[model samples]
Target: MAVKDRDRFSTTTRIRLLGEQTAARVYRSQTRRQARRSRLTSRAALLALVLCTLIVALAYPIRQYVSQRAEMADMVRQKERARQRVEQLRDLKARWQDDAYAEQQIRKRLHYVMPGETGYVVIDPDAARQSRADQGAADRPWYSNVWDGVDKSDASDQ
Candidate 1:
């Protein structure tokens, strides 16, 4: 009977020890899971921080590049306008070189009359006095006054 009692007591002690070991394993597993969760959260936060930093670093240069491109496009448009203006001026210069156009401009500006055409001059006394004064300043040839009169009329017309 004593032997049976002793065996029963040993069995009870073994079962209690096994239960304690199982509880300890459960606690260790829970702590390991909590540690893994915290580690993953920290890694996610670090990834977000790196992404934000990259965005901040690149933003200003990208904006500047876009603005510069727009300015370059505007300059190109101005160059095209200048080129067109040059072409128009070239055409005007060509027209001025034509003999008939040149003669027409001269006749209109100088009020010239052809041979056998009557030419009239309406002189203001004050201007005539000034011209006579200017003529007295030099001992010029007689034809100089006639040429000067023609040039004066052309300049006044313009």
Candidate 2:
């Protein structure tokens, strides 16, 4: 009757129904947001994997290309050095072809003298002292140093 009608049309009953509908809508929206977040995460992971794969695939070839460029530069430097050396040798050969240069080299190296000329050598005092000091080791052959090393090793083992 009238009481039942009053209960159905009460303000509190209407407020309760509206609140429930709002809560349901909020829940649905939260689930949709979560799904979207998961999809975006998967896409980001796939992109990262693709980038890593590309870096790995190109790594070795890029390294080899850089190393080859450096090697080519080194070879070019060696070629230039060799060309300079050949030029120097050619100039030396030309100098030696002259008779005066040949005589000068013979006089300097072999201490040779012409028939009526005096051949006196002036020695530096400082250089003579250095030679005297080095006579203990520098004047000796390399084999002597090696044999001394062997003797020291034998003495140490004893």
Name the top TM-score candidate. 2
Residue 96 CA error for candidate 2 (Å)? 2.3
The sequence of per-residue lDDT tens digits that candidate 2 reaches over residues 1-158 is: 99878977999888888899999999999999999999999999999999999999999999999999999999999999999999999999999999999999888766688999997767667666675336565444455566777888999999
Across 87-111, the per-residue lDDT of candidate 1 in tens digits comes to 9999989999998988787666566
Residue range with the least summed lDDT across 10 consecutive positions in model 2: 132-141
